[model samples]
Target: MVRISSFGVGGKHKSTKFALYCVGLFGLALLVDLLWASSNSSPSIYQSIVSQENVVFPSFAQIKEEDKKKKDGIDKKRVLADNFADLDAPVLNWEKMANAPVPRLDGAAIQIKDQLFVFAGYGTIDYVHSHVDIYNFTDNTWGGRFDMPKEMAHSHLGMVTDGRYIYIVTGQYGPQCRGPTAQTFTLDTVTKKWRDLPPLPVPRYAPATQLWRGRLHVMGGSRENRHTPGTEHWSIAVKDGKALEKEWRSEIPIPRGGPHRACIVYNDRLYVIGGQEGDFMAKPGSPIFKCSRRNEIVFGDVYMLDDDMKWTSLPPMPKPDSHIEFAWAFVNKNSVVIVGGTTEKHPETKKMTLIGEIFHFEFDTQKWSVIGKLPYRVKTTLVGFWKGWLYFTSGQRDKGPEDPSPRKVLGETWRTKLEL
Candidate 1:
């Protein structure tokens, strides 16, 4: 190297050389930037895991608690008026059908052609299940067990179908809302095989999930342990013909409450009804509200999420709605139906009694009424409407205040055709 202070090399030449050197350095930096961007860009948030844990039965304590509640079998002479609450309720026209091959609840179900695929949920304290059972309507029986990639869920797992493929999103791996998993999976209804998609930005349990306009919309549920952090919504873009793209985006969280059991979409609008919103129970002296019990504070808040993704809190569950659980559905665009999960209070007896009451809500008028009563007092059951019948599967019935014994988790399945 030669000193340039004395202008040994021509002054102008030195300046030009320095300028060229700077340009070369800039080009090198640009090349590295392009390479990094290319390498980091990916289509999905998740990769794949080969081996996952198998779902075991619930904890021993829960099993013992359930055993205390279990009855020998269904009692044939069971009558609603004689055994349960709701003195003025009319009997609902439904009967026992067939028992589920596997006992599962709080899972997801989708009817594809003749097969009703029910997956995840707790099996034995809240033992997460890895197997998916397919109920064939044609044969009136269940098909072979479809094993999932992993074992997880109890109570809340996000599931929905596009009449093509079934999508299962986040949920707690173990029961008790502790192990929230982030991965998303899909099954081709025709092929009956499982495939992994992108992972959730954050793991969550009990978040409500549904398929809308070729995209998977997941919202609400517990972000932390059992504490719900208000209304948060996220969506992943899925293409037509059972294809999921690599795009996921955040949606406007609901203004107030979140979904408890499930969210129903009607007339391009989303409705959250009869969901467990808050963790706190009613105050000691505060009168228990409708759908909400003294300690088990539930909400019948009819929150509607419009096309603009805005939420409208409509009529809360019927005052004395009493059905603080999540087994609710819409008969059509005009009317809503709530079944199974219900309870009633008797002022004369001064006690809360468990009852299987069928309730109705009107969307246009925002009104609620007692339509009928389920034969057996049941709660947390799965309801699916197909053909002309509303099919209910696998739920527990508890002895009301009349009996303080632990409630039962049952595998009883039944169906009733809705005339309305």
Candidate 2:
């Protein structure tokens, strides 16, 4: 972990010129008053106009913190208050599932029939993982272990399942995030092998992927090796067998979806939330310096794409506006739940802090419910919803602040029953 800090400085600077103008106006008023007093006749019309203008005066007083914060376009109160899940809030029964045979962060999970397949992602060994780990839902234990093609050892790749085949999109190959690969493959759950399939229209890392209504959706991730964001939306029609001659087509939206934002499918609508646009790695673990595009937002912007391809911006998540990346999951396309991710790094210690607060957004009310806090600290993790269970795995996690232990995840997978 490296210490990250950003610097920015800007202001209107009109105060100085305005003060000079006010001083000149005051001097003119004094001269006019002297002439009016010396004259026996009534004051001039222009002098009367000056007197009226003088009445528009206000006393200089100290500005409150809240008022100042409001002027600065930030609500510190809301962020500080809503950053945690209450200890006494609520919790459904959560039990440990089979420990992840391949525990890695930034990977993905897909359930087909009675088997759950965990795909490639960046691992704790400081390398990208191509090893495939599977767990059987019927047997309640780990299943087959396989390896991805050497070139497909990609991390941060877009992954989605059509129940039979898991489509693995482009992602970074080496430990560094720069080596984004264009090789996409599909895994057969029944055969336990991967086959070459239709690659993406363009190459990108960390692109959001979802399967809705027989169409595969990939949108809102960085392009050009994770340097810039493009509003390219690509979809492919998947039939029984894997065949593609004219399968992929791209459409440019009016306003592009958020780059690197957490995306999920809900209620037949595609949603992207709270992700950095240009670069998610330029200043990893860095603190925000100014209000601009360079700094990744704390709670990320929210958007929903309609069937007509129109994008609608929704209310921002009510969490601390730090740059640490978080994760979200949807329970049956109805309720959206956000869980563990890192918070802002401590200034002196320079350790990137963790967020314990868990929240569920209320659609009808436009508010967030501080549901409950996680017992452990999380930096990066995958949220997989299979059947009635929610599986959490990977991430550089640790014990919470109260535990006084260095925060880290020991590479274990756990699950809890989520009653939708």
Candidate 3:
């Protein structure tokens, strides 16, 4: 080989050229990476999950201490609240309007085309709310009351809409309303007409109802009594505003049901809440079971049924309260608000419970925190939305002899804005 370098000077000069070439290559590679990232518009900040040890439940005293810290001008808690708050902070000042009508609980509610429709709930042995109330957001009107084909009570049954027709799922019927019903019906919101649909295979009341991927998902709910909850699931596909008769598909199983009254569609998983494990006989004279003194021990368990039709148990609720009738609502795409429910011994004769607390679940972090308690313990239906603000309505409170009409139902509505 012909020698290109004679001694140390030439060798050192070659090394310098190699070093500059390596540096130039690195610079060119970085520039290309920056251009690719810019072209793809990738976010500068990427979310990463850090492994965390299992969290311990907060005691009442610990909760009080945290609240104190939040209220004591501590910037950490305040800033955390603002950062993790639901509903965008920009639209926190939106005006809220109420559509007051008759008091109703255990009714079905859904929003379609920016309008909310409520229908079919029970009141007393002799009274029931069969009239459907429609609230139009665009017009700010609330006067489309239609009657249901039948009345139901204490039933955990739910209703959903395909934007045109309302599908009323299985529920309890008869006086006292403890009878198991397999009947399914649909009401045309446009025509104000009702039609019977094929009944569910098994009789269930209050299975968490949600629309999953253009199909209906009914999760855990009570069967004969509240203690005997069913874990069977059902899915139905509707085309042309009508359910396809041949499209009912059985999906995954859920955890046991308890008077389950709350379910919502999020990330294609149905999150079920507040199921009962005791006897709940809405029937006139059905035998009540004595499983435990805690008549209404709310389930602290949170199960997420994913898109693959598999159920995953997320972190449990912070507390337990069974009678949280319709207490689940999606506040946004990534958060949900589980509102007030009942904890019982029946306050009268020292066997009553009335709890008024609200819990919020942050889906992204799988964390739960207590927001605040309600003015009073409530036992009623809950469904609403976070249209830049959280709007909830229509629940019942504790009953008394003077107001003893099976707890005069609530037509009251509330709005809370999340600072975030």
Q: What lDDT would each prediction earn against the true structure?
A: 0.61, 0.60, 0.61
What is the descending TM-score order?
A: 2, 1, 3
- Badly placed stretches (over 4 Å) of model 2 are 1-94, 241-247, 254-260, 278-295, 320-333, 343-353, 361-368, 402-409
Q: Tens digits of per-residue lDDT for model 2 on 199-267?
A: 777677677777666677777666754656656778776644363445676754525533435666766
* Model 3 lDDT, residue 415, Cα: 56
Model 1 — which ten-residue stretch has the worst lDDT? 42-51
Model 3: how far residue 396 lies from native, Å: 1.7
316: Cα error in model 2, Å: 3.1
Relative to the true structure, candidate 2 has a C-alpha RMSD (angstroms) of: 17.0
Model 1 regions more than 4 Å off: 1-87, 151-155, 240-247, 278-296, 319-333, 342-355, 400-406
Error of 3 at 163 (Å): 4.0
Candidate 1, 1-420: lDDT as tens digits: 955566745887889999999999998797666544533542111112112665232344643443443444423234333444354566657867778887765666666666677776666543657777877766567667878775444445677777778777777676433446787777787777777778777777567777676578887776644445446788888753344557578898865543344566777777766655443222334333112233234455667887776788787754323222236555675886777653433433534344466777777787878767666666566666666566667656757535522276666678776766
Candidate 1's displacement at residue 237, Å, is 1.2
Determine the backbone clash count of candidate 3. Answer: 16
* Tens-place lDDT digits, model 3, residues 1-420: 866657778889899999999999998797667544533542222112112655233344644554575477555534533322222212223344674576666666777666777766655544556667876655556777766775333345666766687777887664244566877777777788777766777777677777667776776677765456677888887644567765457877776666655676666567776556655444444454212332454566777877576778888766555545456666667887776665434333434344455678888898987766554456664556646555556767756422211355687666566543
Q: In candidate 3, which residue ranges exceed 4 Å CA deviation?
A: 1-99, 137-141, 151-155, 225-227, 282-296, 323-325, 344-352, 399-408
